[model samples]
Target: MSNLAIPKNKRVIGQRELVALTAFMMSLQALAIDAMLPALDEMARELGVAEGNQRQLVVAVFLLSSGVGALLPGSFADRFGRRSVAMFCITSYALLSLVIALIHDFTLLLVIRALQGVLSAGLMVLPATIIRDRYEGDQMARLLSLVGAVFIVVPVLAPSLGQAVLTFAGWRWIFVVLAAMAGMAGFWAWKRLPETLDPLDRQMIELPVVMRNMTHALLNRSAIGYVLGTSLLIGAVFGYVNSSQQLIGEHFGMGTWFPIVFGGTAAMMVLSNLVNSRIVERFGARRVSHTGVLAFIAVSALQVLAAFRHDGDIVYFLPLMATNLALLGFLGANFGSIAMQPFAHIAGAASSIQSFFRTFGAAVVGLFIGQSYDGTARPFAIALLICSVLALLLVLYSEKGRLFRRLNAPAKPETKPGGVY
Candidate 1:
């Protein structure tokens, strides 16, 4: 059905429902990572992963697979239906999770984790494409922020959820829980979700066409800058995720309270996204994102300074990290919209390619920085500062040095009567 066929006032699963679903889908990514953290030591011990760094492979392998998976799912979504593609991905992911859970050999576990990542690629891109199919500008931003707000809750509770499952059962139960979640998501899509892709608008998934579309997307200077900027932003967060447990557990001596600290910081992200939902319409995405990048830079800089000054107190560190994370709520939604603004023709492929770079690039950078861990938060702090600075520069360049001015500008005139701007 054409988006126009859906009535503006039709109280169906509109933007809010779409956001809720997207949030659920995005939460899968977080759950996959955080839920495994508490189980890492046990899994390592059972599988004989040898070194601490080797244990990280379980996480890194998934991320790597996610990136590679991201590259093709968008094209598939465009050619097929969003709901169908999503169901397929989730089903595959659930099967992979089952494999990861039942396997005893370490190499098999790593291979399963990688396959799980590949399956998750569809989960990452389809929700955004579905949302993009229906909204733009402030409406899109608000929807994304709402989803972002809801998605943050996953990370906040994931570790504790994992711990609870572990306490009751065993480490393998974590994957079992993940399988249940994926199965639930698949059923949700099958039941409540409609096919968002119109048959006439569908594009074939071919290498030449994929390359051409990607090249076109890259050739657009604004899109390129935004993509790179968003990748760096994601890189910072990924680095933090990779290092957070060790930093809190080993360095801060908060092994038991690690979930509390991590969850608290994640809560800040939820709060910030809530705020972004309210203000992004008035202040504009560009303005909000620019300000957020600046705030992140300031917070990251302070973290680095504190680290050097021997004042790396948890009280100070947590607050700073929270502030930095909160800004990501703004950056994540805005950067995504900006990168996608010019590609309405191939929204699915555009979303896929954007996700590929954002997830894959961030994973690579994050893994590199995470490997440099030396039982201190300094590496994470320094990495955050560097990423923020780079993101700011890219945003500035993308906006033609008019980042603040463009953000505060009046909304573009509506193109159609009763259209949500």
Candidate 2:
């Protein structure tokens, strides 16, 4: 059923063009993180990193910084317009990647990575606002799934691409490619993408206004629940991303084939999104995604048992991990759509808050799981199970105990306590 609530008069952008641009913009986050996976160990050694787990700080710190930086994008996007904000972010991202290439010190490199992540917030957080600006309900969910399917190709290709680059150049050259890609994306946005936020809807970027918006998001029951649930799942994905090289390459002895195996597994997420796009319109985002979350929990729990029985043998471990990761496609796009639904009028702020909390949650939980790595997949398996269950509970709370049922309509978020703004 079409969402009757979607305004009939919204400006139309070509679906193909919109999807491609938004997906490309969103893929920056995936590319920045995934492309470096194969090179982490080599980079770690060259940079004098002793602990393998600490290498994850490169990933975790970036995510953490991006989440924090997300606090800035929404209001600014509301004030200055989405296109301008995105351009600044893409340009900064390109320049920082160059700076990272020049930095020889590991600590300084990490600090630069963190800063790059902050700039990355515009790309990561604003896509949802752009989409919400144009669509609502299942239409919104379906579009997001399609864009995610496209965005996911980055993670799918990045490992192998990184390896290929590693063959020809050192890891530092990876930053060169990142810089070049961002430059291209910035150019694309500047030339082709039109501003989606209407001038009438723009808000002044003010401290009091931001605080009120933030408070409304936190107090809104459904939005906050979905945000919390999504955060747990993000944490699980981050934990896996942070440790996949160690588990597959170092632990399973895949060494040279690490990229292939990792790429193949990440491809499952792409497949999941494709499947989601096909079914969500008919089944409803809630039913399809709720079922997906349940399946994720069950699969994660089974993986824990498999780790116990198989003792982290790659044959049993890798497939289980891949299967669990695939389920993420279902939960992520839907959870994000649901969480942002109540804030359609303030999409930028809503997107920023959701991304900030989710990324923050992912970083903290991922660091804990990564630091627990002990030459095995057990810690990772257990972490997935725990995160999945917590996410399920949060979903239940968000849905008011309903699972697999289609929601009647989107709930309007409760306004801030004050009559202000």
Candidate 3:
């Protein structure tokens, strides 16, 4: 007798709808962060923040809590279901926003924001698990890259939108906007988003099984390597986000125009991911992502050199930053899909662990980078190089001493990108 496999009963939907839905779900976290950015200065002023740098805590604390908060949702999604946990997260996130709008004290606001990050994680982490449940291989990478196209829209518009809200209304309205984004996404999800995890694929809520899954995910070299590598890259992004206002507004005097400059750079990333979606099948994730990493390193070095020379103005800095950001757009989707490739059986736990490391570890390093800001781009530039180098080293480890080699051959077996031993 020969054994073959059977496909699970999945609720089929068009690819465009899935991409749009997943992109909206993933954008919830970005909306939470970016939508408040333009209001940070006024927020600091009203909240009585003592130092200029301390203003960054507005973004930092939420991300820290988000990292810690992500540890559980993946397991919950595994045991309960993806849609329920996501809806719960959206509701909790909206409620917390309501609280944040009413709070007057800075300390209390930070605490609530952290809690919201914990609850909002379902919107952040579950999308990855949902994608993993539905697709694998190059198809998964391609879908994720398309999803990135949608994800990039929030950053491009959020700062400007927040500024518009702050222009006439109170800063509190910004949180209201964040809440609105969540509510809209939640409503759409409720109406249209089908449950992706099949009954057979669901994991039992058992202590022993949780331990086994965690151990397996951590011990896998390729998975951990990808997790660590992506963490550094993500940290670079967080670092920039943390210090962007100070760099662009305070240092460069692009205060009101910060949104246009920031949005323009972000739009470049949107275009890059769109291009990646088309070419990823021909080049494979490793080839495309590795090339982006190399490009990132070169840009980082150039950024550092330009910073020291003082030879260039926005002409020099803008293009380098745009190029670096575009390359990052290339890395995020491919790296994530590659890392999650191995953990189909425990996709939720795996997604959680990977996100925990990527989110928390990057936040820690990003905090340091943000704090290191001193009216110079040197710190940001150095952090970028360090992150890129470390990520490349991990990529080498994940590849078992190989670089840019073809990972999948359908007919002939090979050790897979995220495959567990």
Candidate 2, residue 47: lDDT: 93
| Span of 10 residues, lowest total lDDT, candidate 3 | 1-10
lDDT of each residue in 303-404, candidate 1, tens digit only: 998776654368768778888888899889888877776665566888888888887788778877788788777888898899989988887787777767
Which candidate, 2 or 3, would have the higher lDDT against the true structure?
2
Best by lDDT: 2
User: Tens digit of lDDT per residue, candidate 3, span 236-333?
Assistant: 87788779888877777788997678778778888989999998888988899989988899999998888878632667788898899899878988
Question: lDDT of all the models against the reference?
Answer: 0.78, 0.82, 0.80
Report the lDDT tens digits of candidate 2 across residue range 1-421. 3322333333445767777888999888888888898899999999999997999888778867887899989878877778889999998999999999888899999999999988778898888888887677777888899998999888777777789999999999998999999988888887777777766556666787877777777657777888888888888877887788898899889999987898788888899988888888788888888898889988988888987888747888878778887888887888888888777556787788888888778778887888888988889889898988888888888878888877666555444333233
Measured against the true structure, the TM-scores of the candidates, in listed sequence, are: 0.87, 0.86, 0.86
Instruction: State how far residue 13 of model 2 sits from its true place (Å).
Output: 2.5
Candidate 2 local lDDT, residue 65 = 82
* Order of candidate numbers by lDDT, starting with the best: 2, 3, 1
